[model samples]
Target: MTRKIIAMAATVICVLGGFTASASSVAQDNPTVKEVKLRAEFYQNELDLLLDKARRGNFADFYQDVVKFAHYGEKYPQYLLGVMLLKGDGVQQDIGQGLVWIRLALEQKNTEWQKVYDSITAKLTKEQLDALEPMYETYKARFGVQAQKMSCNNEKMEASNIRIHQCRKTLVLKEFYSVYEYN
Candidate 1:
């Protein structure tokens, strides 16, 4: 009886260990790193276009880019879309939706988003800001969690231009000139 009990225990341990190893191997094979890298690359491309439109003061082009990329569910694109709406840059002004995206961006901890937020907020009256408070609170309650806050101050226009140039270089290296192929 003692020998039977020891054999049963050993069999259970071996089965569990095998299961765990298999599970770990499967997870390793399906690594999320490639998906994440692709998303980052896509985002960088969109950001490059946005920076170009912004530098040229072509809000219409910028607005189109915002709508096109916002479909990807990327936080930065959403934030920029909100900024465009809030400032009436390329679309009909809608403060409520704009604030929603701003809050979402904040929740995502995209610090660079703060620059667009600040720019729009500076244009709004105190009454407007007050009106947005409740909506902001609701959004916060739903999705707000502590995230690393990002700052936009001391970010010079020159720095953004440099980034644009770098992005262009990357695109050239990748053999992609236009984000939208003129076919």
Candidate 2:
């Protein structure tokens, strides 16, 4: 699981190579960037645990963790929370809310998520469809990428003493890795 996350990080680093920074630069006195990295690491760790629990079929615990992660503007957890809500896995079934969560995740522009979004929306009832707009607006305002300030725009990642440029170039070259490989 940890390996999978690392591989995913590596892949994202590759795709976001333009955002890479020198280790020395990242180690400088930029408190805001430092804070963002710290928060990202903390959330990533929590997300790893949550994913592990989901893999173990601990839906109840997974649901609780997903709620927290989704609130923190994590896309994958928001998608999972939506699935849970749609099926009432650990909470009451709420189609509208479920769609909203999936919509939020899809807004991040992940193609895989789009498949899920399309399939679900294709079968929605009239009331469910009606509820989507307002709910989507509300969740979007609070959990959307822009609101969360999620951007790959020159964000620094920890690479110890290694030059981020070389490291990212290598990782990006091998695009076969999937974060969901283990799952």
Candidate 3:
């Protein structure tokens, strides 16, 4: 279970795109190490919550919650919504709109999100790209992090001795981490 959690945490950090330090830069006393540690703690809190809820098994409710959180400017949810839109899973199929959500989600770039963005964009024709450009620009202006004035804060969890970081665009709320989450 601990190994599973660490692997999941590593993936979350990669997608979160919060670290740029190379392996050589990580050390026992380095700031990068501290940052990574804090991020792990934050993601672990998310994982614990999400894993528990997922065990209850109501995907429709889960999908709705993801949509809500995406609109709320949480990065991971935005990425999930993008994939959901593209796949027409629990929502209408709309590749163009899906790509838009994904582009917005990549505010903090990582190879994982970049690969998804590139794969989708590569499949688009000139006309499709042209058509989607305006919509993407509009969504970027409206829902982008700068537009939302979204900012993250590290708050101590009342139930535990650790702190969790949450980003708020407008209203603040609690939010998740786990491999089972992706599954």
| Among all candidates shown, the one with the greatest TM-score | 2
**Cα lDDT, model 1, residue 29:** 26
Best to worst by TM-score, what's the order?
A: 2, 3, 1
Q: Could you tally the backbone clashes for each prediction?
A: 0, 0, 3
Q: What are the RMSD figures for all models against the true structure?
A: 23.2, 16.6, 16.3
Candidate that would win on lDDT: 2
TM per candidate = 0.39, 0.58, 0.52
lDDT of 2 at 150: 52
Tens digit of per-residue lDDT, candidate 2, span 1-183: 333423433343344332212233112232221112233345457779898887786677667678766765677788788777656677875555766788888755666667766755555446546646765765666556655545422223486543221110111223321121000
Q: Per-residue lDDT of 75-101 in model 3, one digit per residue for the tens?
A: 767776776666556676555566777
Indicate the residue-level lDDT of 104 in model 2. 83
What is the per-residue lDDT of model 1 for residues 115-149, given as tens digits with 9 covering 90 to 100? 54555455545765666666555433332331111
Candidate 1 clash figure, as a count: 0
In model 1, the Cα lDDT at residue 25 comes to: 14
Q: Rate the local accuracy (lDDT) of all candidates.
A: 0.46, 0.55, 0.54
Candidate order by lDDT, decreasing, is 2, 3, 1
